[model samples]
Target: MNLQPDARRALGAGLVVIALVAFSNSSAHISDVGQQAAVAAVSSTDTLTQLNQSLISANKDKGVLKEGELLEKAVHRKALMEILAKENPAHFLRYVLNASQISSLPKSVTATVEKRISTEGVIDTYIIDDFEHPEKSHYEYYFKRGANVKSLYLVGDLLVRSNTQALITGYEGDTYVVADNTKGNVTIKANKDIDGGSNEALGVQNTAVILVDFDDSGPRPFTKEQAKNIFFNAQFNKFMKEQSYNKVSFKGDVYGWYRLSGPSMSNGQHVIPVFGNDNSQLNRIILENNIPIGNYGRVIIAINSDFTSSSQVGMTMQYIGGREYFFSSSWISLAGFDILAPFPFTWTDLDFLLAHELGHALGLMHANSWECG
Candidate 1:
């Protein structure tokens, strides 16, 4: 039909207006409903949650959001994470958007970022892990690198996205170098050092001697060789190097083993064993004159079968300056090996017990779970 131009334009305009009205009405309703759902879901608790978000928003520190303004309890938790989206978008973008857990993950590793990278954008998923000690006898872990992950911390290992130029800075209490990353994977264990210099990262490069002097009055379970082997094993050597003494790293050397010859040495302790001692003593002693205390920083371990941990297991102590430092050990000879009892013991256990004593000598307290973890 031949119609006037103005009439045709007017008809189109009317239809456009009707469509605009419908869209605006629908959008307003949707937005209002979405906001209401969010408030209702979050208001159940006075505390806001740790965010689990999209790849771009994951790991960003959202300061503690307080729901106390409208929530049931009307109380706020401490503001823990304060990160600005504008200041560091890298962190902001990594903030968690969603989170969930699975029974299959290992406790040693904290979290994982699953990302598939392509030229267009990123598709990321995250899994929150269980940190409580494991219930299983053996567990497995897998380290997978993707575009979204920057750094991840495990029990004793740290995985960073970049693998190049991976040099270990000094590692001390509760920190270790699993793999120097020079060649490949490494085992994780306590008392293991993250040495900056050694190829194995085992510990100090040089060796310092700790001479053991046995008393003639007691039974000796270990021949000089056996005692030396116990203290010089990989575990003991690595543990010693990983430690700090006098506010400095025990960085210079591994402990050397020596057996004093000729006469048996006199035991120095204000207290006695079995009746009132725990297979241990103070690290420093007032030496009986006429006895030679070799070079400064030298430690002499005097072992006597007569000494016992009040007939139980363990004890430890520390000392002050040189004229030589000495420590005493009490033990019962067990089938070819000198042992600490009150429980089943092994060479590894012995290493741990003695290293703990060394820590006492170095002025460290017996660390509880809180401190070590």
Candidate 2:
């Protein structure tokens, strides 16, 4: 069924509730002797038909079936597992049915998962089922692994030669780094949990806006006044205000066009420090300029350079000495095209990016389409 972004965001917020309901219902049914007999009586074909009917009913009602209610029927659960096994047997056997396999994974892979769990507290795993193509179903694993929010894909038990190649192929976030050695092709990806901050929402967040340039860079894409308008103007401010229901808002001053001391192009491409390095560099620059960073609660660094790729647009670090910061690579090339004008050339574009990165800074997470259903 079709759903808009706002609706999808709402669904994302309720995911924990849905998971709890589904787990509890499943447990109750598994413990019921009578329910087990009923499930056993239904043939696989009949069970599949019933599952399809339930889906059709939900579609007719213009609402998603509560996963708990849908899976509460023992027959439906069996049908789903059977479908999973028949389609994506590898994933079903390794991840779904075999809970113990996590520990038995190759040492490097097990260490990666364990490290994430140690740092992020607990790993939240999601199994997404594609009814139309069960084989296309996959998993999303979130590890509240970063001080600021980070997103990436994790491919486990993959038989590959190098972890670097795996990251180049499977990575899907703005900020990522290869955290482990390539011992047997196990790529472990991790990101911050959707609920990962304390005191993130509650007051007017003071922010610092810095526009950066490189020694070898060309003319700035936008004027300081234009950059100021993007951050402090009504469009972005009002959006955050309404989204937080007036509980949160941003106030900050804009600074920069400060040329850093290095060549803009790195190995024939414009590159900037990433991960904690970017934050450290910006912090140093702010201190050098005597900007009194302590005055702000958040920081936004806008660079007048093209990113290596479009997927590398922006990322946020929710905490740096109790303050938050996000970086936006202003210029980007879309779909392998040459570098175009600075991204967010229009008000709408800037508003969405600001909202999204700020949402991560505020402890919100990515919302996928499958989550809605």
Candidate 3:
């Protein structure tokens, strides 16, 4: 056994998020009518016993090394030596071969020499008893120094004759580490997947709702009357529906457009905007001026005069858990303004933008895949 340390680590890491996939013990077979009975008549108890013993021994010796023990330079030789000598003799050859290389064995094991130190092999046996009763045993071994051990299972094969690949430049003794020699740009980063909700149903209480406010200094770009009129409009209402904004009920009265000078504040849709360079500045205005919505409640959009076009535009596209947003200007485009342009310019887009952004801010991402909505 003496499974590779890397394989043990990888398996442990994978189990943190997802359990291992169970391998099926019995595989389906398609054979001629007469073959079924003939194949069934074979006795594989002896072979199974041997294979089980080998697997047990291999499993026991696998990863008997402690952390910080260099896999190279025979650091784990003590643990491995004991297993090879006292545990299971059937798997003794597997450890010995993994340590170095096997010159010859039962013809069942076929070794395919890959580059210099790497070798790939497999052993497939079909045991037939009297009356031509047959049972098949398949083993694939990948022998690669310092390479991952889980890859062997993935490669599929037996303990002795499994297909394996060793990196010629693999580490020595117990450790296997290869040097990277690439000149190209290498990007190492985590992959992030978008979060979208189930589309099969919609609920009013569950719908995304966002309230936006640009801090008040005086009159905002739009008049307060103008903002309310837009929020009540029908076109914007349809847009929210498309973006998965279930139902929105104004939580507070519209405070007319106001000037943002020092800080931005948020009371649902009402905001006091403070002059700032970017979204961070906008965030500051809210943190400084606005009161927080309870842990579970409606969406709030806070706008500030201090927010520049760059800051607003940047905020429109970003995603945050349990929230969503849209800049007033960006809202126009996102609401399909061109389609609604023939109609009056109202606060509908603004309202819908709040709903959409809150959808994301709360925990939603666009589902461009679904056709229904």
lDDT of each: 0.26, 0.41, 0.27
TM-scores, each model vs. reference:
0.25, 0.42, 0.26
lDDT tens digits, residue span 191-265, model 2: 322223234334577777777777766777777787766677746678666554455678888887687778867
Best by TM-score: 2
Model 1 ranges with Cα > 4 A deviation: 1-218, 242-298, 306-349
Q: What is the C-alpha RMSD of each candidate to the true structure, in Å?
A: 29.0, 19.2, 25.3
The residue-by-residue lDDT of candidate 1 on 1-373, one tens digit each, is: 2222232222222212221211222221223332443454443222334322211122233223232321221111111111111122122223322234312222221123222111111111111111122111111112222222222222222222112123222111111111122223223221211222112211232223233333343444455555555555645455454332111223222222223333432456322321111212222222322223232232324344233211111111112223222222222212223443344533343453444433332322222222111
Rank ordering of all candidates by lDDT, starting from the highest: 2, 3, 1
Query: Candidate 3 lDDT, tens digit per residue, 72-103?
Result: 21323423433332222223223333322222
Clashes of 1: 21
Report lDDT (Cα) of residue 36, candidate 1: 43
Please give the lDDT score for candidate 1.
0.26
